[model samples]
Target: MTYATPPRRTLTALTMTTLLAGGLLLGQTAAAPDASAAGGKKVVCEVDKMRQQSHSLRARAARLQRLGATAEARKARAQADALDRRVRACVDADGNAPKPWN
Candidate 1:
């Protein structure tokens, strides 16, 4: 029995896929230092912005709390708190929280 050769389209597709995967791996591994700036420090700045957003959300929650709808206020507060935790994690880069996350 003779082995059949792969179709041209299939061979081309595989080559393209391999090249794309290789490019992605290289991009992730040998990322430029100036861009990422060591341990994703640039992302930490983004984290700060996200945390500020969470603070704003919490502020809205506080306003609702002041309006005496305690249940809705608690829900909002909890959502804000979760965002705050995520932002803190982004800032810390190793699942650590910043001081005064509350």
Candidate 2:
């Protein structure tokens, strides 16, 4: 009786496949953020927080406009626009004005 070993080509292919799978796993792990401490808290990234604030300000401005406080409403809208721009910048740190939250 005798035992047969895998051919050289077969071993090579299996090793390459293993290496490729390991690389993919490492790549995915590196791309994901650690969520250990963020279990309970809603982790709003910087760009998202700016977007939410801008949205809230816009709503406030609309309410003020409905209430007849035109001047204050304009000011609030201006602030909101500025914050929106900040969010855009965060989304596209480059000079190119790419739509941030759409």
Candidate 3:
């Protein structure tokens, strides 16, 4: 009587296939915030989130600058500026003009 074990490559392929299937299933079931479910305040929530993100990015940019990473700091500042513009537009659309950040 004899039994055979799968080759190393076969086992590796099987493991990878199983992991890929599991990842796909998880991605399909992931939940995200829904605008329609927010009762008309979705934009406000989004603007607030953007504000927080921009603030963090700006802080990171400052830290990067102090660390002498000019290119990375510039990138972070650019992203922060973009988010600030979007936040301003969102606030203006809501009829409440945004003030400059302190």
Candidate 4:
């Protein structure tokens, strides 16, 4: 028995898929360095901002406590704690906080 050839459309589709996959891989590798640089800067800046906010929240909690606003103080402290956790998670691989250039 003779083996039948693959249909034309199937071969075309397979070729197109392979080309598209290759193009995507090439594009990603080509852009990766620049993307990481830009994204790293942005992440550092954002984490810095979050750290500042968390600090301010803790201060606010302290002030509220002084004013005898126990409930509000608790809330502020909780928010600050949550922000601290998120900042920790976003810290660099070396476990250092991101230092923004600016």
User: What's the TM-score of every candidate structure?
Assistant: 0.43, 0.47, 0.49, 0.47
Instruction: Please list all clashing residue pairs in model 4, or write none if there are none.
Output: none
Greater-TM-score candidate between 1 and 2:
2
Whole-structure CA lDDT of model 2? 0.83
Q: Which candidate is the best by TM-score?
A: 3
lDDT of 4 at 16: 100
Which of the two, 1 or 3, has more TM-score? Answer: 3
In the range 2-83, model 3's lDDT, one tens digit per residue, is 5455687788889999999999988877864454734655444487788999999999999999999999999999999999
What's the residue-level lDDT of 82 in candidate 4?
Answer: 96
What Cα-based lDDT does every candidate model obtain? 0.77, 0.83, 0.85, 0.86
Tell me the deviation in Å of residue 12 in model 3: 74
List, residue by residue over 5-79, the lDDT tens digit for candidate 4.
679778988999999999999999987666465556644437889999999999999999999999999999999
Q: Per-residue CA lDDT of candidate 2, range 1-102, in tens?
A: 864567977888899999999999999999988765466575334877788898899999999999999999999999999998767766665455466885
Query: In candidate 1, what are the lDDT values of residues 5-102, reduced to their tens digit?
Result: 67977898899999999999999878746545566654334666677777887888899889998888888888888888876666566546455756
